[model samples]
Target: MDKHHKINIEYAKKLGLKSALVYQYVKDMNSDTKLHTIIEEFPYLSNEDVGNSIKSLVEQGLIEFNDDNQIITLSSTIQKTKIRTPISNRSNKIDKSWSPSEDAVEVLQRAGVDAEFIDGLLDEFIIYWSERSSTLVSYNSKFIEYCRLKWAQHTAEIDTKSVPRIIDKNWAPSEDCLDIIKMTGIDDAFVRLHLPEFILYWKEDGRAFVSWDIKFLDFIKNKWNYNVEVTSKEHTYKFDLFDPYADDEDKSKKSTKGNIKDLRKKYKI
Candidate 1:
């Protein structure tokens, strides 16, 4: 009926209403529950305004409650719905019961999240902004190191006792897997120990090979002027021991971001 009431009505629409609750409460000429309930839940309205609006709805016969019996009866069953009318023109055209969107329809069936929470996220303006905002693919130096270690462990899962013939085909390692190998810094013999006999023989069982094309090792070499060759390729064809990122150098050079901005934003979201 007025500006304040208009805002509350819109706000309340997001919160699902139980038809039985509204009808029973409205039936009572003097509701015992503090009028503060409407204001508190909405938080967008003052106590006086929310109380008076509920009173107005009662006066206008929009809601009807019998306080003594705790019975709620709506003047029109349609009047008690959370949605004022319909979400779209097509909805008005359908005489048959409407099915929610593929997503919206799930709420009536599932219990994972409250329907109101999902609805708010799907509001037109919110959806529009979300579509525009870019999502991040997170990466960390230590986490990358962990992945390489895990990859070594993962490959070890293959059995050494498989049908023993050198296969004609070899699968090129994934880029991430290769990066792990580069970062791992394990001795070639250690690398061989982790590999299945099949992988070793599929190439050449007699030789374990390591070659250094890694740029990071060179960066460490020049900056600290540690001429110590950390790069090693332990091969049956050739073998050498080197410390690419040796223990002697300062560990502080490893990049740890001054700020973890992405993690902070994700926490806020």
Candidate 2:
């Protein structure tokens, strides 16, 4: 099977899980299908979701719609047919000011990233790798993953304004809760099983109301200092795009797939 077709099928399934109408619209969309046609057909959808769904499909290379053409069409990837388009003259250019493509920007936006900081975040990622070595790896996928990290960092910095409402002002960890948790053993599963207890204890006594799941896990790891026997999964190294291909660079740095692996593991990407 074609790689692009496989990718579209996977992404379509993901979109389907969100909204069946959106999924069907994506699966059936072609150059002749107008945006208004979709809107009229799926009246239950908000214009924003419909628009977002379209953009997401485009970003994933399932579809394409240029502003000048105003025609929605299956992307070459989705169609499994090539349509010749003007190739960029600067495709081989080497410049310090290079930025991610529009597809990359759409991806960041879909991930709920703030637009203003995207360039800065990309620059930061590039500079981080540049300083370590001249070689770069996994330009598109890694950069997409980088955008996710930046979004996470950005959200974490800006604390949520919603006040933490106590579920029960007088709530205390019951003896049963403690006993069950203890019996569950000191592991991540134990913490997950008694998350309510952890939340109440943290809010009431620890004075920490963690909102992120990762942060909550870290808190449990630190507070309990318990070892969980988590089996480490094998990491598959893939490099689809690398700019200024580092053919002559030292193999050690140029082929340091571990750098990206370490990053993925650290951020749980």
Candidate 3:
């Protein structure tokens, strides 16, 4: 394996996830591998085992899954990926910069005070401090709507965007609480019906929420040709917007598609 791959696998192992997850997520471009594909790629793990691992990593905040994109992805960017070089090659070493916080700790250390806490102060700690100080939060509604859709590119699991978050000090879901998703099935239904406008939003109080337009639900229900329920076995996500040109009655009253009516010389098809 290349040195980068070796580093990625080591990181993945630290989080109890498959090394392939690190490979897929750590590369520069966006990814589209679904959870099923991930499980399939790592043949040794069973579905249940993979599912458990997902729960664990999501809780750890090391990775998140875009249901719409179908990939387990890394969120932490602190660790640098190392590239391999020739055996005889020598490279200059980069030095870590000193910040005010580091300076304070160093002064304390010189005075014989405890400065060890600074060792745990990483760039991520600053992220936490910013969130806490400003009461800002990542409301899932935005992620569910944009990030998930762009990544998954599928309509069915697109509702996974609505999957309620366990955003907290520990991000894992409680057993019965998670089962609520499985038994209720309504959120999943809404995801399927109105995915075009699903949104994840954060409130002013540092809480995140997800929502979509209900009028869209009414519009689709009134316009849909078939008997479609959330769990309906015959449902499809295809919309009629892209069909061959058909004249609308109101528009045709003011205009015409055939040669005779008006302004034909001024227009081109």
Candidate 4:
């Protein structure tokens, strides 16, 4: 038996289910085999799985297949080493199942991401990193952190309604939302403070808020600085036009006015 042809359970675990089986079969054979022969030998693997396994084996340097020949052969490097007994560790049988840490879940959830989205991210992340020759991520913490930041950044980008364009005509900002203003270079604290209003301005103007962080900088660069006081005065005029004493035909309309007025004062429109 050639050592190059032999594989340990750990190596097989990394190769995963279909790839592991393909590797074991390749190791057992004395000569090169066609892709169809391996598929015929193992009836369970789907055509797609067989193809993926072959690609994985080729990437890992365990096997070689030339499109010209369409035959699978154990690499000469593997053929030169002495082989050992086949894998017997049932626990090492590989699959793609993985559980994300609770902290990682919480981090994403705080940013409005859910389980299904995280699962997809994890699948792509695992597949990408596992195939690379040298992984930069040496710890689970780094991986979790990567998921958390990327998830928030991307999630914010997709959520069309997350950053609303207008909360009533009179827009206001809270202390926390003020964080957005600090990052942008616009000097006016009022503009920084009424950042949400600016978001609403863009929204009402039919612009998509693609990047929550960048949109502010862009707004300031284009609009906010042009006629800052006029924007402020117009919002105030709209606020005054609202009749607080108007007939509340549908009692629900009272709350609407109150909400508008509250937002007006809160944002200092």
Runs with alpha carbons beyond 4 Å of true place in candidate 3? 1-9, 17-30, 68-71, 76-269
The digit string of per-residue lDDT tens for model 4 on 1-269 reads 01123445875778886788888887788577755456545544454567667777776778877543345678863332342212222332212564455644675576566677777777766666566654221123334444554554565556544564323444343322333333232345546555676757665777544444445444554665556577767766777866875666557687888999999999999
Worst 10-residue stretch by lDDT in candidate 4?
85-94
How do all models score by TM-score? 0.17, 0.33, 0.22, 0.26
Error of 4 at 249 (Å): 47
> What does the lDDT come to for candidate 2?
0.49
All models: lDDT?
0.34, 0.49, 0.36, 0.55
Decoy 3 TM-score against native: 0.22
Q: List, residue by residue over 1-269, the lDDT tens digit for candidate 1.
A: 01122224443463323322333344443443322222223333333343345444555566543322222334553334331211112311221222234422252225233455434333442343335533211112222243333333333333222223333334333444444544433223443343443354446633322311122223322432332233332243243356556654545333233235566677873
Residue range with the least summed lDDT across 10 consecutive positions in model 3: 79-88
Deviation from native of the Cα of residue 93 in model 1, angstroms: 69
What is the alpha-carbon RMSD of candidate 1 to the true structure?
A: 27.8
Candidate 2 vs. truth: CA RMSD?
20.8
- Model 1 TM-score on a 0 to 1 scale: 0.17
Candidate 2 local lDDT, residue 94: 24
Please tell me which predicted candidate would have the highest lDDT against the true structure: 4
lDDT, ranked from best to worst: 4, 2, 3, 1
